[model samples]
Target: MLNMKSRYAMRALLYLAGRYGDGPVQIGEIADSQRIPRKFLTVILSELSREGIIGTKRGRAGGYWLEREPSAISYGDIVRITRGSLALVPCAARLAYEPCDNCVPESECHLRLVMLAVRDATADVLDRLTLADPLPGQVELQPERQAAPAQ
Candidate 1:
């Protein structure tokens, strides 16, 4: 399950991406448009700023903007930054891997094996997709048609 912070961050980033070259977007506008809390968004944006994912300005006209082009940032990078690991479990994590405590040895652990596969598959999809990609809900899909019955 995705955490609220990650969800909010993605929303904020997407909103920023839409306004990429238009200049900084005010926090209140983003919050009201995306339905995220102002305080929470402030914290998230600050963390992203420190991570170099975003840039901020200060003044009467100051606000936030992306540091890099949206296409340069991948969903995987965002997930890793916010969630620490794409792996469903710690034992399956690549950068943050840890042996399961008081459990079967790694080589023989089926759970770990399954999780490894899951992590890789998840990474494959997320890494290939950038923030510039159209979000799932944003795209329209054709509805399936019914098949005729055989005589």
Candidate 2:
């Protein structure tokens, strides 16, 4: 499951993406528009700012904006920055792989195999999607219009 921090970060990024090249946006405006808590947004923005994903300014005209183009930023990138690894389990994590504390050796573990496939599928979708892409429910919710993967 996606954590709240990552979810909020995505929302904040989407909001910024919408306003890209416009100018800095005040924290209050973002919090109010996105319905994210003000205090939590401050922390999230600070973390993203440190990552150079977003730039900020101070004073009455100060706020935040994307440091890079929306198309340059992938949903997977945001999730990785906020959640560390995309894997639901440590053993299945490609970037941060670790054997589960009490599990069988990876070579013999079925659970790990399933998790690896899950992680790969998740990455496949998220990495292909950028902040500039219209999310599933944004333009319209059309599950039937989405094609299934080739066998």
Give per-residue CA lDDT, model 2, range 67-140, as digits (tens): 99999999999999899999999998888888799988889999988998999999999999999888777774
lDDT of 1 by residue, 3-103 (tens): 88888998899899989999988999999999999999999999899999999998879999999999998888888888889998889888998877898
* lDDT of all predictions: 0.89, 0.94
User: Where does candidate 1 stray beyond 4 Å?
Assistant: 136-151
Give the TM-scores of the predictions, in the order they appear: 0.86, 0.88
Q: What TM-score number comes out for model 2?
A: 0.88
Give stretches of model 2 more than 4 Å off: 140-151
**Top candidate (lDDT):** 2
For residue 81, model 2's alpha carbon misses the true position, in angstroms, by 0.4
Candidate 2 colliding pairs:
none
Q: Where is model 2 poorest over a 10-residue stretch in terms of lDDT?
A: 137-146
